[model samples]
Target: MVDERTRYFRRLRRLRNSARRWSVMGGGLAAAAAVLTPYAGIGLADAAWAAAAGASVALAGWRWRDHKALAALPAPPPPDPALAGQRLVAAVERFPAGRTVVHELRRQRTRYALRGSAVAQAWDRLDRAAGTLSALAGRLTGPGEAAVLEAAVAERWLRDLGQRVASVERAIPLSPVDQRPVLASSHDSLAGQFTEGVTAYERLVAAAAGYVAEDGQPVVDERHPTLTRLIEATDRMRGIAEGLSELRRHPAV
Candidate 1:
């Protein structure tokens, strides 16, 4: 992906070019009108002057707004990648969910100091979670669904899931031969927990679709059965995140 920041700067450049083009056009029009006015008869002269004034105002005003907007946004980030931990930074950018999740994980990794494998593992879980969320979202709003899922509620679930996934991955550490099973168990549990939540979302969506197909759409709120089940599922995932947080804090030696 081109990334949002890159696209943002591209937009600014396009707008700047447009502003420059208009400014040049306005200046030229005003000058042309000014010169023509002197050679015109009384009525024509007045019309030419008005045209010049209008053109000047139009272009000049556009250019002013352009400059103001350009100045309004934060200055472009340091060009390309920064030097410190540049490889890790680049790897973080490769995350499907984007930099925010990875960055936060790294920030929380004060103890483990895990690197390569950590990145690989975290990327995998997060990538799968993102795809799962997208699929769940599509099902939630699919044509046959009884009701649309609220964007705010969906966002809340996503935020909680993503943060928990990151924290869990960050907490998982590399182990020697003996500790491999322990690590495997942790991985399996985390994977299962994630899968369970996804299954829950699918269950809810399918149930809603079937019911709506038969009885038609019903009023949905937090109290709605299907909606409440979703909330319960998401809460289960939140509970897992909390448990993972505690595990990270008191990891076995």
Candidate 2:
């Protein structure tokens, strides 16, 4: 059965086709009327010619105006490699020294290096998934066939990755060493940051999906508020993830 989303897209396509057809039909009818006016009578012929000329001018003007409007619409920005890198760095910084999570992550990292442990493998998968997302985001600027394909692929990948991240985040245990008030606070802060990052990442993924649905055209309706949010969220998520990853690699004694 056709899904609701498929039906919606079909409806949009129909509407666009209908509009174009009507515009052409209207222009053609006006031109025909102008032609018929001259044939009606000699006295009316001059007036008919003038009317025809006016109709032609009006049609041309309308088309020109429509073209200009489309041309004036802004395109979406390209992905920023530097910004993506910075986000990763920021995420890494969120993990402070002497934290239980950091120590645990560090142990896993060592095991992965020595024996390719499952925990290490999971972390590596997450890193790879994040990298895929970043690569997809970078290619979202152009309006070519490749860009459209990339957007679609990215949308699918983001959805899958978001789910995976959520699963991992949920499975993470709270730090067991929160005996001291300071440690407890830090633990809470770290958890909150990670959760926020995941939410932001999901939002970015959703935005990408919407962008693909719109056929990569920058619609003027909301002016792509989602896209703006996506950028901000991406940075936030990257920073948080990077900090956590860094803690895994280099934990405090």
Candidate 3:
């Protein structure tokens, strides 16, 4: 999986690199053509070649923008197999599992020195909550009435979360490195979208908390599923938010 992710990043980097080079080359040629056309005589062949060159330049610029948008996105971290496997186990485990829940609580309590204050904290809580939800989701074995209901709710939440994560991921490519005004506007817009996603996840979490309080049970029920979905959504939002925090911490080249 790590190998696959690395390969993906490598391919994207190569594509962006190629696009940047092409944009520069095309723009240069376009400028050169404009300069030469006046003095070189307006022959039919010259006009045709110039038109082709102009089109190429336009295409290059389009590619450049496309690639740049991708490059600007926050790079996702390589997955930890050990961690993933551990989380999988935790997900199947009963709620309030000492081993799983405590670990996450500690991480949240620490308050790591990261930027994007609200976004960062929100994500940490979401991650911690997700681990327990994973366990609950897994424990709902068989297609019993409760099981089916929980699964449906959990699945819906998961799907919504996936969409929110994708939105933030797409926005990452819009980051601006230079030009303060343009960068600020772009950064705020992208960051705002991310924040909204986070907020949506939080509402879900709150709903989950309400459910657990009403039942006083560790196992997830139909109501629990809605909460579970929100918790999971929070988890993904946190992951993406964490990425944004890191991006802000370390300026891009």
Candidate 4:
């Protein structure tokens, strides 16, 4: 049996479906009435009803066009080596930039959150990368099934990472500079989460590359080094985090 909430959603879905059908039906009837009214030479009252129906049809058409445009927005791209490389580079670039910006923002006695304007750009980039993986899941062929699961896990990791970053911003008090211990801890947590996501994607890419079609052909070319470069980029970001941690612990003169 369906749960009550599920049942409610099901009912809502049905209602929406019915509404769509009626909208179309109403529009068609209106158009037909308008077109055929002239031959019938209907009275003015009937003509007014026909005109109103036609107007309703036009409104429905407009609504349908709007909905179609929204639905037509492209989904994220597949996990191609080129796309991976681009994302990897993008993620790495943002990692340092985010740190720098957040550090500077902390110095200004401003509250930094994941939703903060400064870090939001970085998060958006990271989200786009994750979205690319998600889009690829639907495009994957047989034997590359693991990529789909990995994409799902990656999405979850991103959400957790976002929360961790937000927590870091919140853990510190508003100050001119970010010198709090919790900031470092939160940064470490955020980096760890990022590494987890990257590692999962690496496994996903490897599995996707290894996938053999029913005809015994590899899905991804081993010779292309872009994918390897993408994996290396993620590793480099992980290394950067470690280096940052070390610097924070043993400040250089």
RMSD of each: 23.5, 28.1, 28.3, 24.4
lDDT of each: 0.59, 0.54, 0.60, 0.61
TM-score, candidate number 1: 0.29
lDDT per residue as tens, model 4, 1-253: 2334445555555555655875877777777666767665797866776777766666666666655554465534445667666565556557878656654554344223455633455455555555455555554766456667756776666656756666666666663365777576667667666656655665665455444323344365553467678999999999999999999999989
- Global lDDT of model 4: 0.61
Give the Å error, residue 52, model 3.
Answer: 3.1
Residue 91 in candidate 3 has what lDDT? 65
By lDDT, the better pick of 1 and 2 is 1
Tell me, by lDDT, which candidate is best.
Answer: 4
Please tell me which model should have the higher TM-score, number 1 or number 3: 1
- Distance from true position, residue 196, model 4, in Å? 6.1
For model 1, how does the per-residue alpha-carbon lDDT over 1-253 read when each residue is reduced to its tens digit? Answer: 3545676778777777777777777777767666666553647666766676677668767766976787698865643554535666677788777587875575456224434432334434444444444455444544533344443354346445545554665455555668767766775675565555555555555655564454545555426678779999999999999999999999988
| lDDT of model 1 at position 76 | 52
Best candidate, TM-score: 4
Which ranges of candidate 2 are over 4 A from the true structure? Answer: 1-132, 142-179, 216-253
Compute the lDDT of residue 204 as modeled in candidate 1.
51
Candidate 3: worst 10 consecutive residues by lDDT? 110-119
Rank list by TM-score: 4, 1, 3, 2
For TM-score, candidate 2 versus 4, the one ahead is: 4
Better of 2 and 3 by TM-score: 3
After superposition, which runs of candidate 4 have C-alpha atoms over 4 Å from their true positions?
Answer: 1-113, 116-122, 174-179, 195-253
